[model samples]
Target: MRRVVFLVQPQVYLLDLAGPAEVFHTARDFGLPYELSYVADEPEIITAELLPVRCATTWPALGANDIIIVPGKQCATLEDVNPSERALSMLRAHHRQGGMVVSVCAATEALGRAGLLDGRRCATHHQLQDELAARYPAAEVVRDVLYTVDGNLATSAGIASGIDLTLHLIATWHGPTTAGRIARALVVYARRNGSDEQVSALLRHRSHLSDLVHRLQDVIDERYTEPLRLAELSRKFGCSERTITRRFRDATGLTPLRYQQALRLERAEHLIASGTTVEAAARAVGFSDSRTLRALRAAGRTAAAVAS
Candidate 1:
């Protein structure tokens, strides 16, 4: 099993620790081979939110595929927070051994101090970006992005962005479909790859507050590859076909059938880009023939060309 170890520190941000932890935990629940653990220099650490958290004092043995995450903490400035040399050494040793090391928000300061950020591109919370850059001259501090991954070392902008970063990692390890399922379980949009234009079609058109439409979306997202009937959905949801169509359009600016087609088209594009043949991609995404997939691809290209 792949172990995910969170290196807990004093004044750790609660959300920074919980968000990614929940993503891994949820992924584990979905039968992924993941084990979550927490370690710290002491048995108890007081969080930034004034809550006491208990963790293991002894570090666990980690393999190359394992991960160690340093969650962001609360500090006035980089100088105000001093990490133990043992902790820094551990961070350096783990990365040197080819294990993955991650930092969230101000925790990038810890990675920076450990020399892991030297000549590496990293990201931190927006408020600490300037200070992180000034303190670590060798590190390239990326701005306006949720996270950055340089080799085995990764850094995120903390808080909710931590979730995005973790989801990205999950997608890398598993696939986009598994990550999308986990995101749906968390009631969040599927991982946004640090760009509005790159949001996954699995999560697009999900900003509305309509529970009915959202449920319809969940159904479509799960069964887009199958032949779904709006009348069946209307019967299942106890709504008229007209109501389902109107509400879906009102919430997402697309009918249910169109939304499902969008999912199929996006997935087909990914498969094709990954070297799958057009006919195979069409069959995989549930198209009856290559002609329909070709038509959709042509229309998509036309739309993009027009938009440009």
Candidate 2:
């Protein structure tokens, strides 16, 4: 699970390559096992960014825990791909060996051409949704989505969605606590669970900056499990309650109390996902009772339903 092999191609989009790669790389910062390697059909490939990416020309053998990522290029059509038979064979072989195959943007073409998408549900950027279906009639080209997982194959939409999909994979493998730590460092606060609503609290209201708010956030990050009061926070930071509430809302779009609740809820979720009971997770995360957590989860469901 430590090794991640990226298959680079000429004219590949730099964001498409870096978005996912950086996710795994950032996970390493949180002490996750991640070793990255780059490979290509040639010694080097120029990106759409006008940058050169050099990689190993020879494909290495991969194991079940390893993953292969094929990022999309600047292709308007499938013919835009310079199909390397050896690269395709390596992809097919790795997949057959039970390794994960991840494709971003138009790189779904790689999976389709390798016969990996046949009758398998996959996804890509919104623009190429129709083209993927038209070209690979047997493949289910899901659209208007962040990512789709069909068994061992994971496909994602364009650009930023690559990071979202990679985070999902990391969460699945290592639990949400590890993923949440990485997302927080990346300044990504929220993620959609491929639900009907493609937004979440972690993603809302986050495009402003305030030192006061940041200081408060750092304190909350360290003491989310403790009972935190607005008056105490305001006094501790030498700010009035009005200024604290206003600035916090302006920066993060959540009240201080709600922000703390979100943090607790996220940790509670990770514990629950790791097989802790709802009751146990609630207690572990400093929830007074499981009923409160259930109410929060139910409210979240209602919010998503309304948003959708």
Candidate 3:
């Protein structure tokens, strides 16, 4: 079992702790062995929202595969946040032992205090990016990213982004399919990547509340690499093809086929970035040939340029 321990601090941001925790907790429902626990210097602390939270006073024995997450707290400045010396030492020792250390939002200040951010790429809340960089000059503070993972250290921009970061970690350990399922369970429209500064194609144009379109998007998300027919989808969803098509377009501003292609294209770009050949990436995403992929890529670039 992989133990995920949350290092809860005083004045903790509830969402920063709860969001990632829920992702791990939800993954257990899918047969992933994630053991959740919380630890803090005191047995009880109050949250930033003025809510009481109880936790274990003692830290658990962790192995290389274990994970420790430091949830962010409310503080006027990075210097105003003070973690116990023992906690800072524990953070350092955990990293030295090859265990993963994660920070959400301003809690990255704690990791920086522990000297873990030195010479590593890290991210924190946009408001603290400058302060983090100034304080930890040796660390490469990445801006405009949801999160950054360098070796065993992972830091997120905080708040809801913590959920995105945890989902990404789940995807890394398990697989994209498993992560996708969890996202669907959470009703998250899409899993944004660490590199995305804006909404992803999978997330864009998904603001409408049509249940049928949402369900159709979920199916396409899972089967984007396979041959999917609108007729088959219509029969499965008990709707006519024309109705499905019109509703999908009305809800997402794109036809179902276009939505599937967008997913395929997004994944193909990632594969190509990782050194896959154009033809191989196209084939991997269910394109009949590289020519279609190339044309789509060119069109996307032109559209982006026009938008800019």
Residue 156, model 1, lDDT: 93
Q: Over the full model, what C-alpha lDDT does candidate 3 score relative to the true structure?
A: 0.90
Ranked by TM-score, the better of candidates 2 and 3 is 3
lDDT of the structure predicted as candidate 2: 0.83
RMSD of 1: 3.6
Per-residue CA lDDT of model 2 for 1-308, tens digit only, reads 46999999999999899988989999887788888999987898999989999999877768888999999899877779765888898889989988899999889999988989998999988888888899999998887888998889999987878888898888778755566567777887666564344433344444456778877877776688899988899889998999999889888878989988887887787678769999999998788899999998889789968977
Model 2 steric clash total? 2
The segments of candidate 2 whose C-alpha lies over 4 angstroms from its true place after superposition are 174-205, 222-253, 266-289, 306-308
What is the TM-score (0 to 1) of candidate 3? 0.86
- The candidate with the higher lDDT, 1 or 3, is 3
CA lDDT of every candidate: 0.88, 0.83, 0.90
**Candidate 1 wrong stretches, greater than 4 Å:** 189-191, 196-199, 209-212, 225-244, 265-308
Model 2 lDDT-worst window of ten? 195-204
Residue 223 lDDT in candidate 3: 88
**What digit string (tens of lDDT, one per residue) describes model 1 on residues 100-197?**
99988889999988989889999998899999999998899998798988889999987888898898788667766778889888998746875333
Q: Report the lDDT tens digits of candidate 3 across residue range 73-177.
A: 998899967899999999999999999999999999999999998999999999999999999999999998999999999999989999999988886677566
- Report clashes for each candidate as comma-separated counts: 0, 2, 0
Query: What does the lDDT come to for candidate 1?
Result: 0.88
